[model samples]
Target: MNSFEKDWRFTRNSGKGFESAELDDSSWEKIDIPHDWAIAGPFSPDHDSEVIVDDPIEHTRKVFSHPGCTGGLPHVGKGFYRKHFELNLKPEQSARVEFDGIMSHAEVYCNGRYVGGRPYGYSSFALDLTPFVKNGTNLLAVSAENPPGASRWYPGAGIYRHARLIVAGRIHIAYCGIRVRTEGNRVTVRTEIENPSARKVVLTTRLIDPDGNEIASCQTSGDRLFHCEFIPDEVRRWQPGNPVLYKIVSILGDERHETGFGFRDLTFDSRKGFFINGIPMKFQGVCLHHDLGLAGAAVDRDITRHRLNQLASIGCNAIRTAHNPPDPELLDLCDELGFLVICEAFDEWKRPKTPRGYNLLFEEWSERDLRDMIRRDANHPSVIMWSIGNEIPEQYYPEGPEMTRRLCGICHEEDPSRPVTAGLNNVDDSITGGLFDAIDVKGFNYKPYIYARYHAAFPDAPIYSSESASTVSSRGEYSDRLFEESGRKDNLQVDSFDLCCADSATIPDHEFKGQDDNPFVMGEFVWTGFDYLGEPTPYHREWVRSSFFGIFDLCGIPKDRAWLYRSRWSKQPTLHLMPHWNWQGFEGKEIPVQCYSSFKTVELFVNGISMGSRTRNPKKLLGAYRHVWSRVPYSPGELKAVALDEKGKALAETSVFTAGAPEQLQIDCERCGNMVFAVVSVTDRNGNLCPHASERIDIESNGKILAVDAGDPGSAKPFPLPYVNAFHGKCAAWIRNPGKTLILAKAVLNGKTVQTEITAEA
Candidate 1:
């Protein structure tokens, strides 16, 4: 496999006949793979096209010119990309190009001849280039179109994932043709082959242990199917707490395929929630969109690894790729980093949600896409379940049950080892229409309100909160009003108090109780783990271009609510306070404060004076483990919280002080391979970050600038530019390494320049 990523000429919006190898593409913009043409937006309402979205505030479903649902970017159009490569293949060799993902309808051309095309962009596919290619030089062209109103959220444009070229002999293993399954101490290996000459190809399989030692070996010869079984001396079972993986290498003649899998057993039980390798535990999961903040829907392994690490740090053990099939690299990272995953297939089946949604081609492509998803990802140990659809309106359609049963049957047919589920928002309708009967596991979307009632009604059904808590908040912004039903209409920010939840959704604290109240219920996956590019609830205006449903903001910075989950899910000692100490106008007034702690008792101090000590009250709605001091006097000094164990020994302590006026800029650099993420924060004379600051910052780097963003979704700021405004006190600049030992990033604010140097690690 060879990377087909770099040196691609791209033209956006308007183009024709560019797929021809004879056409001149010198004027086209040069770019690399895993690129999103829509990310660098000159955001404006003028780019708006009407798309129907769920609006609970209007009391009924309505449609209007709400471009915020798609991030108000000019993304609905054609994106053509062409690349030239030298591949001198022998007569006995065959070639194909595999795409991890494409945004929408993607058409591929090899040397000006149409090869293959796929309608659904989320599903991965490969196009055979053997028939249309020449001997020496070849041109590979792709035309991907993101149709207007095709998606509910910002479905990024163009080839936004890794691409690879595969060349194999005529008698080679098919793409993703290796299937590995484990039952107890036994491992089953199934390899599919393509033998044109009806020859019995020699197939060899070797199982490698985690420490790079060959533990088992088998030899077989077959024309189509090669099956082998091996019971190793000992098995290292995979668990979310400690993911240990083994590798398998299969060879057919000169062609070889390598894949990593783990040995583990997981099941969903109606009586005792979920179990991993015989031990019962909750699935602390989050629903995540495919977009990676600055990277848009384009996936980067390094950047995604950092995001997954952050989620794992806050005790998130599982993930549900919300509403669509995720980038393949995300699953790879989840497997390596130990996170359970629910590989979702589609947001809509046959009924159209948006004007040009997947339903437009669901009739022709639904089964193929579903089968490809299952076949491509069946071997991953992290993917314990397959989610067929998410909140599909088909639950109410007359033919919904038939389609549901068909999809479930397809899943079982492709991979019988895993369970099938769907995000059923209309739970009653689904149950009544036989859609619920087809699903092996019940997935409730924003329906924790019915967990206890449903468990009583169907005691034998295994149910989990597939999509829960839709809490909305903006980092660093505070509000006196706890619950803003419609959110704040006056500003581009939401209150960090985490009370501004959507009407269709409840706060995180409420869902926390929902899971606790019913021990038989499986865990909940929050509506989102991080802020996304679109589907901005409550804010239909063009200025609000992203959703505030995440525990972390768009820049991957954790909000105060992260502690709320850590306090409950994590066994590690955790204590955190919210609402910064620098409320300029609320001086000497009563300010409500809240602290999330795992300790038995917490003592709050204001200006070095003890306010009081409080213990965990299990019956309280939000105060069970979250300690709250509603009437603490605010002053221009310091506030502290000390968590104490049952015996009154202090386990952890944290404090927030009143910061001085903004004075300087601070730069912190985090490097992942050749990519450097330079974070610029506004600080006062005492080096305390100003949570409310939005200072204009000009940044420069010795490396190439990939993206300059302060997580401002509404801004039309050009990403390649060096100028940005710190959003919620800080901004982030992503740079590509220019083959330097040390990379320098400098930021200027208020005539003072602060720079940080990063060494390229590995």
Candidate 2:
């Protein structure tokens, strides 16, 4: 029997057998684990996009109002989860209940007594329920409350992760940690096994090659300590370009466990950069957050694999699981797909606390959280670094050096194979140097200017622009303008490009745009790879919002920036076209248009109506273009541009553009403001803009007359002055006002008239 079946009983009431009274079930909703409670609740619409405001105070207020900001257990009101399991525990069998993750806070009760509470959302915790559980029925109740202290970013609540009832033998291996160190052909494999049971047991360890061939095996008799070593004629080193992994499987009687192992020696030499497998390898990576688009907090392995595939296609061989530990599936995928991973622990420097309506830092909780994270994810071979925190508030704690050191110590003690690092936002000399002693690597967030100062201070320390962006900074706050401004101003007294480049002349041949420092400066993890959901505000919604940090949209559509990354990273011959219009303007004859494609050979055609084709010109074919031409025409209908590869296989096609006279415009108006808008644009049968169009707009309402002005025929402008009253009932605007006291008429765009008959209060 499994651990859960051996220790716990099956019961009907979630609150039964616990120390406290059963929670009220009236407001409780029955739900499954790995669920996002926000999707089930009625959060405001503003909780769906990024916040664009500048003021920090206003940003805080807006952040708190979103569902993702609400902390505590999954408290979108009150929710309860209860499960009953029948367990027949043998005399020597042991059982424990493990929750892989719970959002913010959770109160777990096993058979009535309070088992424990977890505050850190991403870390996993387990409870030994052997004592409390009975033979027949076990009642497990979980009360989750979503507090109002969470961040505006999406924190899908409830048991938004996995839950497993584990069962083991009395002398089973509780935890196993393997640390591999290599010097030349001699490899040292340090293994630590914790046997909580009192009895003694024998364990066998085997190192298997990639093809499942046993390279080495060792048998040790002990429940508490097990050490092994292996030496082979040829060692396969794992690196970014050529990732080779080996498997180490441990067998304890009938139970078996396996973990991937990479035989690589890593060193951080200030002069040579980071070296893996004794060879310098730049980390060409991207930072990825946990949330996955509109899918909320659900763990869809296929979706994650698809995203990783996309990242791989773009030449990103490494990923930094930013801010927190990602789903186990992500690590597994990385192991299988051969990508380097930096598993992160926390977002804040300290444990997040809710005191007086604000989220505060709890130091003790922070240490515990770090301990839990390191202990949990220490086995993944793909993980090379243990990132403690991400962009924490440095000003809050002046002794940031000490705090970082302590965190690093905790990580090292737990798992020393991986280096400890944090994503530092403040690149000031003091802050960077303060963390230098603690951090194994110097990781800067959007601070390419400080690289030189850091290298100058500690020339031997491995430095990297942990996070960098060409257009916008992470968190969607700063833009590319900030980088340029700092790059141009010699006031900083540094060579911006020299300090920022991730690659150098000594490295492989690559492009060197002004202020473009990558690979040479080690490497940079772009802000994000995919658009995530939540963090909605009024400004960011109603359009393509959701952090705007990713290169791809929520629907998996590659944004323009994605192309830029591809061009820089992949350097593969490619073609991308963005027409002035969508597939909405095509008639019998081809119309004059512009086409953008990054290809050696290009041909333009509208619905099989071939225009002209271009061969490799290096400059013209690869750049954006606008050309006037007439070609084979199509019947009055929609038109689409299609691009073909050298093999003539269609690479991409645009949406069909409709050909015909454009639809008439529709408009609406209110008392405070006169409004005019068009639902559709007027176009010729060939989808070209119609010529010679004019419209008159007028606004009339019961309120006092406001100033009026006509808008350009080209622009869909609102009525002059008051369109909708700031504080009043609805009003109207028409194409032409008929001076009737009861009727208000205003001229609108697209040659439309809006008339509203109203009765004024007497």
Candidate 3:
């Protein structure tokens, strides 16, 4: 039997009272293990007393427009939580405490010796309290305090993640860490079990196939070092489109733990793009922060899955867990759902921050934190890379390089199987001083044009735009400035004037534009996937419920850009249109027009009169058109468009647009291609894409049914066929044609079909 098992105690603590005081069962609040204090009770409008509580309209207006204040009510601090558990340990067993995550800072005591304290909000840390823990009737005390100046961006106070008391033998298997090395079809699995006990013991490791079948197993014995290996004939490789994973289960006596690992190799060939298991695949991924919408720091498995499903719907294949190690649930969800992930560590460099920076360096706590994250998440096949930090001290810290080196070294030391990386905002500094050499792979945050520059500087280093913006407008303005201006400057020159000017000038616009004009860039994660609450913007007065940059709203509603992304990423047939209303001059003319569709052609009608028919663009797979009527038509009536296929089958239709007066319908096509598109701008006296007085153009097309492909929106290659049909139609046929294959034949109208000689070629 293990020696550590005797000292284990599992009891709940009421996270109330001051840090110095001991918490008893009576003082503890009886709450579930996984809970979010911010989302605990009703969203009371009365709670606004703590911040600024005024008129609802005024509050909403100000919250959306301003920064520093998220118009929503602030979270009430000083909460309590408690859970109960039973431990049965033998004489030889020793005990340790493990917590998946705790928000802000926490002080833990096992039977009153003050086991340890942790401040980092995102990462997990464990404490050894074998000396203080008793066999029976032991009380575990934890005091969780919300920092005074904690981020207003929804930092849920108290113990938001899972907590457990691990009672195991001294020679027990450590938290499962599985590594698979593959050479072509041949693969080898290496399993490590940490034996902290004085006595030697045998540890058995088994590989569980996807079908719950044990493919292989091996055994080794030792108190400090135990290793095992296995080779399988049929190995499954994990990829975005084809995600396959095998479970690695390590058993020590009756205590068994399992982790899923993908046995695939990932490498980047500069000329050919990224390759997973020797097959070239694009990194169509997105950057995701830790928050789960309004749920705050709480780890919600369902919510996480919902977000992943939403991302998958838009064809996102990869996920960068931005700035910090997300809840373990997220990694597990990624593994199960088959999305590639970049597991991240911290938001800042060296130390954490004034509120709590990376101050816990060289301490036992730091080691425990790093070890917990790595060992717990090591087996997840979705995690392709382990990021050490995000935008860490590029220009401010003199010891930036040293700090990076130390972090990289620590990450490698903990888990050598995965490559270590840090998100860099300043690629110029990284390339010039060789500061990025410490990392196995270099990651740039905002720069898209530096791919060649980095390749030229470090010929052998593997690099990626870790945090490229989906669109310049999505990241605001200065983002482009940072990318463009930094490249223009001489590598050796360090001019603060130019840098300052560039930084100040680049401000992101909130308006949505299609994809940016950069294909050389491998992949880009839109700043966020879901609208996370707590991030305050100067635009919204109430605590902005979610980040404006997300493609989806907090309620998981798809924004206009999401459809745009779907149209670009997935090869599914689609049609989308934006209605224009509230133009300046035209206010009294009935321009009743309908956009009608079959499977391939779209028919437009004005004032109940057939106008014209347009064929879908075979190459671009998109179409747009407009129809106008004069003063003879009654002012302000429904204008619609319907789309159809070659057989004149109705595919989809558009919403009604009331036209007023004699207004000009102006069309603007952003990209010129085979896809027929028109941005209908309704102008009164003058012409513009009027926000209020404008009506959107309807689109219709037919070909084949398309499935939604998951991938990164910014850098995702345009699908051969469009995927999003915006006319609220469920089924639409799409034609698949890469280039000009069939020659133009003839037009068929009404009952009359006109025929012309056409040549069909591959």
Candidate 4:
């Protein structure tokens, strides 16, 4: 298997005879397969900007609101990729080329002959190369074209994912054709063997547990379709927190194939929400996009693992791939790490979200794309739901019901184990018109207000907030003013302590209590858990690089809201205080304080003076539910909160104090093999994090520096730099190296320079 990530000849300009094997291509530059040519260009402002008038409601290019600002980078036009290879093929072997993903319009050619084409960029496709191969030297050329305005966000130009050549016997186990299902103590294994050779063969199968022990075996005759069942003495079920997987290996004469499956029993009801293996659980989930900062559209396993682990650390139990299918590796990691997954298929259906979006090609590609996504991801135990579409405007059209039924039917035909769902913004149309009846569960995008009303009307349907709480805030920056299309520039700054959007002031808290009051509501997947590239709505300044809707910033660093979610979702005794007590103007003045804790009551202290204890209100008002310590006199000293359980015994205590000038540097590193991420933080003399610090820090490491991510969406700097300006006194550098490695980071502020070193394990 090959990713073809490096050593490729690329050109942005179109040329005649470029796909020919004899063409001279030395003028073209060398690049990697998972490369995004546009992000490498200088940032642009006027590219995706719209004109503002008296009212922000009448803004142009309203469709751009979907994916956040595209980081003001070029995502359109055409680029060509060519890979030259020489492989001696066996007479009985057949070859094929597989593209995991590509950007927009892609056309493939082998040895100057057209092979196939893909109109939808997100879909994974492959073409037979047996008819076009010459056995010795082969020139595989591909041209990817994504016109401007073709995408709703920074779709990343070029062959932005893995591509590989596969050589196998003509009669072998098919790709992604193995399906496994478990019930009681018996495991059902089904295999689809490709027998184009008109030859019959005997196939053998075995089940291997996580301990690498073979527990069961079976034999069957292969005639394109084969099935077998193995009954073990015991079964270890797969759950959200404990994902136990077993491997199924299929053997046919000399051909062999293996895949992993989990033994799980799932059921859902309006009252119970979701249950895996008979245990009720809430999906403390987040919606994640496909792009990784600096890495662009390429799916790096290490980088992807880091991002998911970051969410897991903050108590994220599930993931919803916002609008499209994610890299296959993501599901593999999810299965191992015990994360529930909702693998989505598309962002739009028959109707176009953008003037030139996927709908233009939906007529021909939707079914195949949907089939590929489902087939590729069906075996993973982490996948609990197959989301058909996200906020599809087609749901309101005349043929809505029929279209919904067709999509859901396709999913059922492909994988019957998982239920189908869609993120519907038009709740009234979906439920009243019978479109909702086609899906097993209903998912509302931003309609938490109508959840109770919907439940009252139709109490039997399992429902969840497929996407919710689009709280917009910048890391560290604070502002009391609100923003508009023609609003003041100062309104763009977001206050860390007051992280709430105009749509909903008390986010998560408001939605949290709704789920508690309505047991029928499964749970919600927030609009985002991490800030991502593009869709820079509320903060669309020229230099802005990312959307600020995540609980964590772009660099995977947690924001102030992260603590609140942790306090609400985490099982451990959680207590966190916000707003550093270094305010200059509010000296000795009473400042409204808030604390997030799972405990029943919290006691507050100001400079060693008891500020009294407070408990959550019995009434479910937005302001009343969130733990608030009204009017605590502030001083340039310490402020602490001690959490107490229902009985009044102390559970946990945390403190925040007036910090001194930044005088020290701290770097914490998490290493896995050659990939390492060093979190660089600027702190005060007492080792307290200076939350408001934005000092530019230079980074140097004894390793191949892949990227530096700071999680600052409003910063002007691109994410691929060796140095980064700390956002909320924090930033991180991603490095790739083997053996013992060291990283040094330094920052200068107020005539003082501080440096820190971090060493990664070999």
The Cα local distance difference test for each model comes to: 0.83, 0.53, 0.51, 0.78
> RMSD, each candidate, Å?
2.0, 15.2, 15.3, 2.9
TM-score for each model: 0.96, 0.67, 0.67, 0.94
- Per-residue lDDT over 1-762 for candidate 3, one digit per residue giving the tens place of the 0 to 100 score: 123222322222333342222444543344555555555333332333223333232334232222223224335444444333346567767677777677657677655557786777676777776777665656565656554434435566566777667877655555444555445554455555555545666777787887899978888776655565667777777777777877767777776877676777777554455677887665667787666543456665555676788788877788888766788888887887878888887665444442433454324455556666776677677887888777765424556677667767777876676788777777676655556766777776666545666666566766666765433112111111123232122221111111111221221111111112223334555566665554422222332233444666443445444655564455654454333333234455432221212235656554466556666443331232211122123323344466776788777776444433424433332111222111223333343322332122222223121111111111111122233211111111112233332222122212233222222222
**Which candidate ranks first by lDDT, i.e. highest?**
1
Off by over 4 Å in 2: 1-32, 45-78, 176-197, 278-280, 350-361, 395-397, 449-458, 470-519, 535-545, 583-762
Please state the error at residue 635 of candidate 1 in Å.
1.1
lDDT of 1 by residue, 293-404 (tens): 7667778887888889889988999999988878888888888999999999999877888888888889998899999999999888999999999999999977999998
Rank list by lDDT: 1, 4, 2, 3
Give the per-residue Cα lDDT of candidate 1 at 597.
84
In terms of lDDT, the poorest run of 10 residues in model 2 is 503-512
Clashes (N, CA, C under 3 Å) per candidate: 0, 62, 107, 10
Better of 2 and 4 by lDDT: 4
Of 1 and 3, the candidate ahead on lDDT is: 1
For residues 174-245, write the lDDT of model 4, one tens digit per residue. 777788887767788889887887677788999999888998888987579899998888889888777888
